[model samples]
Target: MIEFWISAGLLCLIAMGFLLLPSLRRNRARAEEDRTAVNVALYEERVQALEEQHQAGVLDEPGLQTAQDEAARELLADTDGDAGRQRVRGRVVPMLAAVCVPVLGLLLYAKFGAIGAVEQARTAAEAPGTIEQITARLERAVRERPESSQGWYFLGRTLIAEGRAADAAKAFQRAAETGGRAPAVLGLWAQALYFAGDKQWSPQLDALTDEALAADPSEASTLGLLGIHAFDERRYADAIGFWEKLLAIMPAGEPSRQGIERSIAMAKAQMDQRSNAQDAPTPAKGIRLRVALADALQQQVRPNDAVFVFARAVDGPPMPLAVKRLRVADLPAEVSLSDTDAMMPELTLSAFEKVELVARISRAGDAQHGEWIGREQGAPRAEQALREVVIDALDKGASGNER
Candidate 1:
């Protein structure tokens, strides 16, 4: 910034030189012209007076000639060294203008120029060559602009990449607070917290994921995190469910799609292997329900709209014990929710004595919030069979009002 000002000042001086130099030279030329005119007038008057004196018989031809010679000599003497003696006037205004030009230019620039942006660009151009340098720069930036959510988020991501999970978590938390707890920000914060705790699951992490999903059920980061957690815990079915939802929302040709697909296949394989190894007869400890959209709302929903069928404990946690995702086009479909469909190993449908079954139509594919809903009138036993749920009621506060 100082360098920029110095260069600007030099350029201004050059411009002022261009303006003032010409005016000073013109003033000097005008003064010389004025002195020449006065000398010429004085010579003319002396010659005329000599003619008048000679015509009046006051002097002879020789005397007049000598007088004219004297006049010419006097004129030469008067004009001698006049160029050096004469002072060029009218220079004050030009000098003042020369000084004011730069001052006024600086004032206008201060009012309208983007000096701060210029400095930022200059700083960015000198990119940090190492991770440590980059980290330090980001730290400084966040300190200077604490309200900048993006700055904090990038800093968090950088820290995560550098294997500083605990610091990353703190950065992500700050990002979430400054960013209005946006779904993506919350998801990242939860992920950082999970890794910071050495992959140990906690209620705080769960709450963060829940809040993020409540805002945007299709948030990819939260889904991915949950899937990974389930997979690590050997909850193959739950992992498959979470990964499948994430896969559906991911764009085609995404680089991460292939990995997620591989994960889903592995989870499915694990589930099959476990099922095949079981020797004991598995009793029917599950709920069977048929779900269908109402005839009146058929026009309001699209064929590809998401349909979520789940069971939640009647007097327990708000999260679903078991969940199955379907589409509106597959409505009037029968789904069975059992321990195999549990979202968590300890929170299976059979673990909840009394549960409420619900079917929701979410055009945005959000399981937590939907456009319409239907549920069983009262809490029913987990093994209740062949119940029917109709999607007939408007869902106001879909997840929150489910109690």
Candidate 2:
């Protein structure tokens, strides 16, 4: 607030100074103009006096000649009076001082009055990824650059992440005040409000998502969350529609695609089961096996070095279902696989039957084989199922197929 007042005062001072500038300049020019005109008139009078003396025969030839020479010398002396023009140009100093004073004062005022260094130092004291760190940095960034709506949006998100719901809402409101609503900001702000327990703001989520969809309907996060919301409301058809639309937009094998795939599977299963109860023939439901390596290692589902799961028919393209990466902290004596399903978003195993299955943890950002299963009938029953695949494949000499 103090900074605002100081800036306002400085701006007013600058405005007033500029307003006074042209008047002062015109007055100075007028003074120079009057003096120049007076000097020219005086020179003319002196020449007229000399001419009259010569005409009146006030002196002989030598005297007239001497008088004429004196007049010429006086004319030369008056030439020095033209220095007034230099004085007019010298007005530049005042003009420059007029400009410099306000600007310099602004700089000095900012240096001394604004809390820049203090904010920067405070921001630096915070560590990345920590709530405190994010908060301090966010505050400092907003303070330093209040005009940046993007920065405000980021600060709002940080505030939300830190659980400062009221502050986050205010920050988001300020970001919107900039009259530039980025889709990411709108979506995030809606999420923040949702987390803050304001169901009224829920519609904003749809509005924002719709706006984003207008640009790129395939945006995964937007579609995924909206689909989830629809499914939560028991709107299975709506959920399926959203998921399918998202599926069409997403790349094959993308995590989002997997999620959409699972939702689709679940929705279809529900629909088919409903139809079956109504005396309809049960349609076949395909299986999609997705194995995700989750462990204390690399953190859970980090897509680090954890194994990826893939299942394909003995003679089909290897369909990649899911990638699970672990972190160094996540490594433990045992790795557990949870939430494995044919129709789940993270993995899809039902896509193939009578398949060759492989589970491998690789650091190379892609799935590889650490365990191999031949003719596996169903999803792994336990963590041992994952580990035993290696044993069975080795015992059967199926290891000869690939490393």
Candidate 3:
């Protein structure tokens, strides 16, 4: 700015020289013309005095005439002495050119000069270039405007972005102290405290988050931070709950939606794993069996045929509660069906009080039906012995009643 003012002042001086120097020259010329007129007046006064002397009879007509001629010659000499001033007289055209030169220069400068661009460039040169410098500037701004909640909040956020969580927590505390009790401010303050405490979920964090959520139930930052906290503490179900709420409130076309959904999926998987682990110690349920083709039906079955061993609720849905499969060559092999082998979460062997075991030989390797089958009915037991099953007859369901 100083440089700008200095250069502007210099240009103004140059313009004044163009404008005022011409007027100064004209004033000097006017002074010279006034001096010439004074000389002519003095000569006229001398000629009048000589005529008066002749009238008083002090000189003849020739003496008076000679004196007048001498006075006229003296006036001519005086005019000739200032010949340069008369030759180069000041004119209206020169004065107009003097004024126009400065005016046109100013107009051209305004049209062509990039003053705004230059000023921006100068500002950029003095801009902060490092984290420390920016932090210092932000701190200064906050200090200068102590009542400005926005400035303090922005400074806190900037400190957090720089990974200075401890310092950021202090800044956020200051903001919370000075700022309105808005949900965003409270959420941000809680988030900073959560990180500052090494991701621990403390009572202070809970209170802050509660306040934030009480004000704005859908505050995403608080919800996200809570989810992260629960996940870090191995509370996967809690994490899923918080993240699902966050997902529900998120606007359409948000870029982080996919990432948040992925996080929720991962949390759900972790939740399932935790459930499985908790259930591992509980008593197991299901049946054990050994299946084979009867000796009498040896020639009726092929070695490459597939065998399926399964159980289903006797009076409930026909879908298998659990199942295992093998090739005919591996028949007579023992197998167990347990809740651990359930096909789906909602369906398990332990869910039923009674089930029927069915073993079948299907050349097509399908469990739905087979060319031959054998069956037994019993209560689903957790620690039962392997009961022998022999397939010796044709599947009679095709002939009459479907089993």
Best by TM-score: 1
Arranged by lDDT with the best first, the candidates are 1, 3, 2
The local lDDT score (0 to 100) that residue 78 gets in candidate 1 is: 71
TM-scores of all candidate predictions against the true structure? 0.53, 0.36, 0.47
Candidate 1, overall lDDT?
Answer: 0.87
List runs of model 2 lying over 4 Å from the truth: 1-126, 159-170, 198-206, 219-221, 247-260, 277-403
lDDT of 2 by residue, 121-187 (tens): 6556656977777778778778887887877888887887778876886788678767476555555
Question: All predictions: root-mean-square deviation over Cα?
Answer: 19.6, 17.9, 13.8
Taking all chains together, the TM-score of candidate 3 against the true structure is: 0.47
- The candidate, 1 or 3, that scores higher on lDDT is 1
Please give the lDDT score at residue 270 for candidate 1: 91
lDDT per residue (tens digit) for residues 1-403 in model 1: 8999999988998887897788778877887788878997999999999999999999899999999999999888777656756543445666787778988998999999988668767877897998887888788789877999999999998898888989999998999889899999889888888888989999999899999999999999999999999999999989999999999999998999999999999999998888887965775478888998889998898999999999888888888888999999998899988888988987887776788889988889899999999988545674456888999999987664656
Q: Give, for candidate 2, the lowest lDDT window spanning 10 residues.
A: 388-397
For model 1, give the 10-residue run with minimal summed lDDT. Answer: 84-93
**Candidates ranked by TM-score, best first?**
1, 3, 2
Model 3 has a clash total of: 0
Using lDDT as the measure, the top candidate is 1
